[model samples]
Target chain A: MNEYTYPIIAGITVGTALRVFMLRTDYRQYPTYLHGKIIHLSLGFIAAALGTIAIPSIMEKEFTAVTFLTLAASQFREVRNMERNTLTEMDSYELVPRGNTYIEGIAVAFESRNYLVIFTSFVVTLCYLAINGWAALGAAFVCFVISSLLMSGSKLSDIVTVELSELSFKGAGLYVDNIYIMNIGLPERQDEILKYGMGFILTPKSFSVRSTIANLGQRQAILHDVSVTLGVFRDSGTPALVPLIKRDLNDGRIGVFILPQEKDPVRAKEIISSVPVLENAIQMPSRKRNREG
Target chain B: MKMEKAILAAITTQSEKVTGSTAVFHCETKEEMEAVAANLEAILDGIAHALSDRLYIIVKH
Candidate 1:
């Protein structure tokens, strides 16, 4: 066997292991079924295989095999589209729809993970090519941590303070920490609201954080994540139970109101803090100010 | 005095007539039921708050 043989094997083993590590159906409950997991795992293995083989193929001067990497890139793009289409179809049936931005983020994450598998394999194999097998294994462990960190990204808690807020009704309008939510009509419905509704106040630490939460898409995501974590007290055709997130007109503070089947304010706060800030929703106003100066 | 969905259905069905009626909005606070009341008839009949955030206007007609 050639000296390169063990390096290829090491790359495939480490890279495939990392890919499997990424398969988790946590709080989001995405890819809810076994079939979905299987599809992604299968794609991950293929990605790792291509990545492991690329260096050796180039060393052997078999230039044509490198074209397969381009082919794999296009395949991952299709996977992203597939995830988006499935989520959108299911979202139409949800009580609190996870707006398109959140759906797009999930699709992007899945696609990017496959690319991560490819990257881990390439890096590990390159290390193997340069050093002994034992050293390469240690280097692979470090590579694993780096890959996971890249995928983790920043969370909502990084920029805001999420806490339980009082839910009150002033006249016909619902108020969460003085933020005006939509009006509530029907006495029994109001009774139901008083019974199971919970309110959360997300106070931004800075102007950019304020703008991020103010974004309609980000607010919708907060509602979707919270409702997904704690069951929604709503069904189709019951628009009254829809979750709402509105901002204080003066200070730009966001208030979230939801009628959850299980009203645990502590858990609701955790879910909000854990929510990923939408990349598209992040508003860097200071950048503009700097440019003006 | 509670509003019923039947009244809302009727008002929705007779929306064209309601539009022609004099619009004297009682509660100017942008509540949907208040708007519904304004659209149903000239006089502010009454306001009813329903299932958190849902506004309904029920007229005797």
Candidate 2:
């Protein structure tokens, strides 16, 4: 009777406090599929109750460490499950560069807030066991404190941050903001040159389009083809001229153009004249000058 | 052994769409694996829980 009393009280205290703490905190709001804290607390109470009832007939050393280890493993499993669930959810969002930093900080804050309570309860339980000699009441008290602290601390943090700046791309003709354009070359052979020499090639054989809604709002399904020529002068004794023509698409402001190595002045002029603002649209001379210098 | 069986049984009973889902377990030794298996078996033995559309395990040995 004496052995059972202390353990029973300890178990009850732990179980009740844990339940209360869970109810009072916002930990219940986090989305987790695993309910490990409940299991851990319940098991703690059961262990304390059993300890008290069997104390007189059993020695402290008679209790197997495997039992305690198993309980601890279950608790660990719950923690892992919760962490996995949270991470999986976060994977669905497009996060900015600094988003991960914010997540880490939130996780640290939660850990700091809960670690103190858990440590205190653990210490209290050890002290009670050492001083009260294997009695149910003392064991129960310890279990109650530990379980309560653990349950309250279980779900301290679970928030995800998403960012919106990493969605910028380039287009032709006009300096459109927040849009992506893909350039595909004609004759197919131009693909090898563009892919190996120019840095404007994209894999998977499709035009690139920005994935943001605010930029285009609606999808543009029309495909257009236009051509342009670039004039280059060789520094031989006299000026030797070379011309290059390229075919591309024009969408008012954004152009998806492809350039071939050979020159075609007539085709270039024809295609360039069709663009809305032809005078301002030509930029090859400036690009060439920059590259030469 | 038992726990793993229980968890597998539970997962099987909960959903049929468990093809791509993974289960991850951290085990250092055979003894640890056996212990985890036992606990898993106990939790999954007879209880029924709603299973996700797809659920799998990836053991992290």
Candidate 3:
């Protein structure tokens, strides 16, 4: 085989491996099925191949081949749309549906990650052809580190303090801390809520964070993640037993009322802390205020 | 625009308490009113909210 063939193979291998490493079937429960994984892996392979071949084309003085990257961009954008459609369709059946913001965030991640795969392959191939195989390996390691850092968004714990609160009822109203969640007129339903319901209060760490945590989509994402992890204590036709998040206008704190099947407050708090802060839900009102002042 | 929330039925012990376009169910006792409201909540797939000791209104959210 020729010199470019070995470099191309090395680049594709590294890129595909990076993609596999990134594609995790974690508690998020996405891409968990075999078919979903296959689709992503196939797309990752195509991205890797496209990235690796670009370097040799440039070396051979075929500048027209660089236009292929634009095609990759549009293709990856289609990946985002596919992810959005699939997640949105399935969300309706979820007990605690992941809001549109969370779905869009996931879709964006899928799209951006393909670009990262392309970048990783392009860098690896350039190193392999320019220097040697050893340099390519080193570059691949650096790419992995950078890709991980870029991929991971901040968590809820970074912006808010999650604390378990006593769920109390004032007449028929459900109260989590001082924040009123909702009302249950039925005493039987109220008893069921008391037996299974858990409440957590999230206090924003900063002024800007108050607005961010108050976003309806962000609150829904928190509920969805916790419900998925701990198992929700709800079913169809029982709308009164639904999980809800209510905000405190006085202190900019939020009260979360969840009815998980497993009544473990400790694990629930940990899940709340670990919930990813959705990119779209982040608001920086203080930044604008500071600039205006 | 579509109404996001509407009172589906009103179960009340006091006949004079609830008046509007919504359906009203008058109960003889507080127990009967509670039973009626609970059944309405389940059947209508809505939440029954108590306005007073005599009245419970089932609202779809």
Candidate 4:
């Protein structure tokens, strides 16, 4: 094979692989059918091809060709919009819908993965030009593994401690470790809640952690995730059955009350613990106060 | 003793005074909120069983 062709092949192959690696088919089953898979795959391949071609274009002193990358950036932004629109439409029908924040996160991730593909191909092409094809491929693999590891953000456990709290009913009031969750004045409803409901207390380790969990969006995301994993008990029009995360005003600890179709405390705790600490929710009150002082 | 019964009794006993205004019960926390709702629902069910068409709108703050 021609030396020029080897670099392009290495870059496109590795970059496409990296993009495919990031596209997931989880319980939500998003990006369904040909339209979902084909569009992204084609876009990713095009992104990879652009990156692979850029190095050769530069070597040939064809500076005008580099403008394509700028155009590609504008196109990728639309990819984010596409994901957001699709997920937003789907959210209305969800039993336990991913909140706007979580959907934003998902949309951002989809857009970022395309850029990641471009970066991977750029690295592979750069390496291929500098070294042999085999060495460049190996380097690209290492880069892929490193990038994948970096993609994982800090989980809730890193910021707070999640413990399974006792779900008890006091007459009509529900208490999850003295954090008065809510009252259920009806005996039958209270009985059902006690029988099916589960609770988790998130004790933030620091003031920052407390403030982060206090964000209403973050709490809603947690409830959304828990419901998705375990399933919600309520159907449409049953507002009372919606899972709630209540903040303890005194200490800032968050109390989560969820009545899942399947009562599983361990799974509930695990999902809460793994919830991504949202970018907007991380507040450092003590830090701010200290800085002011 | 149940939440539904409590709300029903509250409404039935105080129907003359309540008139059209909502009977708001403030529970310092969400537990109080839930308790009020459960009671209200039970009361509604009982009313329905008794073949009464008296309708009440339920809202939580």
Q: Which segments of candidate 2 are over 4 A away from where they belong?
A: A15-24, A31-59, A63-67, A90-293, B1-61
* Full ranking by lDDT: 3, 1, 4, 2
Per-residue lDDT over A110-198 for candidate 1, one digit per residue giving the tens place of the 0 to 100 score? 89998998888887887888777777788789878988888787789999988888888786678898898876655455678888999
Worst 10 residues of 2 chain A by lDDT: A154-163
Off by over 4 Å in 4: A32-34, A286-293, B1-11, B21-57
Which candidate model has the greater TM-score, 2 or 3? 3
- Candidate 2 at residue B27, lDDT? 51
Q: What is the lDDT of residue A103 in candidate 4?
A: 84
- Write the residue-wise lDDT of candidate 3 on A1-293 in tens digits: 99899999999999999999999988989988999999999999999999999999999999999999999999999999999999999999998999999999999999999999999999999999999999999999999999999989999999999999999989989999999999889888999999999999999999999989999999999999999999999888788989999999999999999999999999999999999999999999888988999
Quantify all predictions' global Cα lDDT against the true fold.
0.78, 0.31, 0.94, 0.76
- Give TM-scores for every candidate, taking all chains together and pairing residue i with residue i: 0.84, 0.26, 0.98, 0.83
Better of 3 and 4 by lDDT: 3
Higher-ranked by lDDT: 2 or 3: 3
lDDT at residue A145 of model 3 (Cα atoms): 100
Model 2 over residues A1-293: C-alpha lDDT tens digits?
55445544553454445433543323222324346445434543543333333332244555564265355445544544544456446634411111222233333333332332233334334444456535434544565565455433211011111111111222211111322332211112222323321111111111222111012211110001121123222212210011111122332223222232334434433433332211111123345556889
lDDT of 4 by residue, B14-41 (tens): 2343444446444444444445545665
Question: Which candidate ranks first by DockQ, i.e. highest?
Answer: 3
Please state the CAPRI-style docking class of candidate 1. incorrect
